[model samples]
Target: MAKQSTLDKNILHFLGPKHWLTWLGMGIAYALSFLPWFIQKFLGKALGNLHRALSPNRRHICDVNLHMCYPEMTIKERQSLTKAHFESMGIGVFEMFATWFQDRSKTISKVSFHNEDVVEKALSKGKGCIIIGAHFSSIDLCGTHMARYIDVHPIYKLQRNPVMNWVMERQRRKIFSKTIERRNVREVIKSLKQNKAVWYAVDQDYGRKNSVFAPFYGHECATISHISRLAKSTQAAILLYDYGRTEKGYFLSLTELEDYPTGDEVQDATKINQLIEQQIEPKKAQYFWSHRRFKTQAIEGTPSPYSK
Candidate 1:
């Protein structure tokens, strides 16, 4: 075996004691997974409520997002939504455990697909597919089930925790057709040109250079324009890929775009944002509100929504 680097040794030392807590939580989640589905769900709801109470910083972020997006709603209404979102997020943590370690067969059985034929039809053409993925709390679980149906090459970021990162990558490799690093633009384009399905999420704010200030829920949020470039360059189809967590399980779908890559980057980006809004509208609490979505302001001197 190769010798461990000093950094590796240090990471191991730091993680040695603390890692057990994560492992213990994983154990608890796994145990709960075997129980009746409703019971496990109840446990997740309880856990989420506890987390919402304890995690003030995250709750604050959610509050900011909800307030900005739903300006018409009363503070009380937003608070209620935030509470429910946290509960969904709490259950999502358990869902991650289920995606990574639960019986693949058992979890896979729970997922249902809608309008998947759209993806198949797109791929049937010579041009590849760009699956416009979004951040929902149960994204990992959704991706796992979606991979069972299509050979989706998902874009992912490296985990900060080295051991956990390795585990995550390994689990993804086992499930998805292929996993692409978020920064690998070349691979993404190549996959698209080769007529493969590449899943990409452009909702997060990545600052000024590569993004444009686009309207998302009436707010000028920084949205990536690279997706437009990719579509134009490869002439690939843009399909909306998102999942909703129902009382029974997850409902994942792929909705094809009619006139995307309209040769106007901002317009295409706006259309993408609109599609995302449509998906998140009905299931507001199910969407991933924990992210600092409006961090990058369109105005030069405006305050960031996330600035405390």
Candidate 2:
């Protein structure tokens, strides 16, 4: 833990009037994180409702995504799912704060690992394990718990808000074995060569550069087509890391992909995408739907599905 004096020095940069909202938000998150788990759930749902009411654009994005992905769902069912997703997002906020502020043991105690042996077997190989994850509502928070089972390095993207980004990085640095930037491919490869586990999230559209159109939820979505090459280059085991809430609590596990990286980029991308789609089906609402996932059309000049 950082000393109070050091934390105070860190907060000095955000004392200006423009950063008041960030300061207030951080204070609220800090307080909420320490609340009882049950109370946090209730308050998180309420906050989700409030956020849904306030953000039409984001809500619409979710609505569009849900519709495109699950056309079989009736309008009412989709609407309900959308609202529930927002609630999950709201709860995720609490989880994020708790993850950053609470003890590692507290978060680890709350989660159940379904298949740690899978991870162990992968690590048993001389090569490191390449753990690919999707955009779950509480990835970083729950991922911190999953790390208890395996010493996994997480690659994080920088938040646009520098203040919040700094705060998150500080906390993340403490809990994680090592933190790498999402774009730092060289470091990721080097870590794998060192027989270290790295949790790299690959379920988002990073645009056309080094990406290909792959089937995501039955639609052709832009996906990065480098996992196979990455695996081959690093001689690492490829595993899909999955975590979600269930009737019990949060369940997290790793599924090893055997004989992977057939050395076909498109085929490899499709296989990974299919696995993600199947995994996300049960925890539909917990998946991140607010992102403009299909913003980059597979067909050049085609309009984005999320367009108003």
Candidate 3:
């Protein structure tokens, strides 16, 4: 918790004319928060279409990612998937509002879970559980909702904008037992030692240091080895936490990775990537294809596939 004086300073700083755009954006978010669900979704669709028109570079990134991951798909099919992905990302924006502003009880009530006992059984081991999250668009809501069921400690990267970071941190504090900074390994390990559920997103390209080249969607990806290291150090159980939005509601799934960490970091990373791949296979569009997941190359001096 920050001191009242610091918070006051931030509020005063954010009130300056230079931050008018931030204020306007936040105001729109607040206004959309009260709108009907269907109307909000309609606006999200419009936002998606606008993004597709204005963000050609991001669209190109998504196109390249989808093409590489799904080489068997036709060009038309990949484009369709890319468009749907932007829509999902747009919906995710509204979902961020629902998550940070909507009633916590209502949010938790809507999540229907399968194999929830898997989480309980893993926690029963008394070693804590590492909930491995991917870049699924539904994660913003699902991460917060999971806290209602378990004592969650989510690892987050700090936003570059100070005000934005403060706002998000304030909201996340309401759900997570403790929000761990991504760089603070000691705190993360300490949380695990206390038998707390620590959530981490493993599907990212973090370069060579502390990462290994592993197969993701049959392509070599620079996968982080920290999760495997954490599991090994704490003797904690690793569980894949995934969710999808259906016509009914959000379907959250928890599956324990059997015989994980195998004492081989690279092999464990590959297994983690495989698990994430399986989860997104059924709903490819929901996965975040806009990110440069294959940014890092396995071989030195090999040009990035996404580079122009």
What's the number of clashes in each of the models? Answer: 0, 0, 0
Which runs of model 3 end up more than 4 angstroms from their true locations? 1-10
Model 1 gets an lDDT of: 0.81
lDDT of model 2, residue 129: 89
- Superposition error at 210 for model 1 (Å): 2.4
Find the candidate with the highest lDDT and give its number.
2
Misplaced by over 4 Å in model 2 are: 1-13
Judge candidate 2 against the unseen true structure and give its global Cα lDDT, from 0 to 1: 0.84
The full ranking of all candidates by TM-score, starting with the best, is 3, 2, 1
Error of 2 at 251 (Å): 0.7
Please give the ranking of all candidate structures by lDDT, highest first, separated by commas: 2, 3, 1
lDDT by residue (200-273, candidate 3, tens digit) is: 98898888886998899889999998888788889999888888877756887788888888989889888888
Candidate 2 lDDT, 1-308, residue by residue in tens: 22221223466765799878987889888988899889998998999999999999999999999989988889999889989999999989888888888886775666888888887788788799889979988786778787777888888877776568768878987887788887789989888878889888898888999698988888898998877888888789988888987756788888888768887788888899988888888899999999888889889999999888
lDDT for 268 (candidate 2): 88
* TM-scores of all candidate predictions against the true structure: 0.90, 0.94, 0.94
lDDT of each: 0.81, 0.84, 0.82
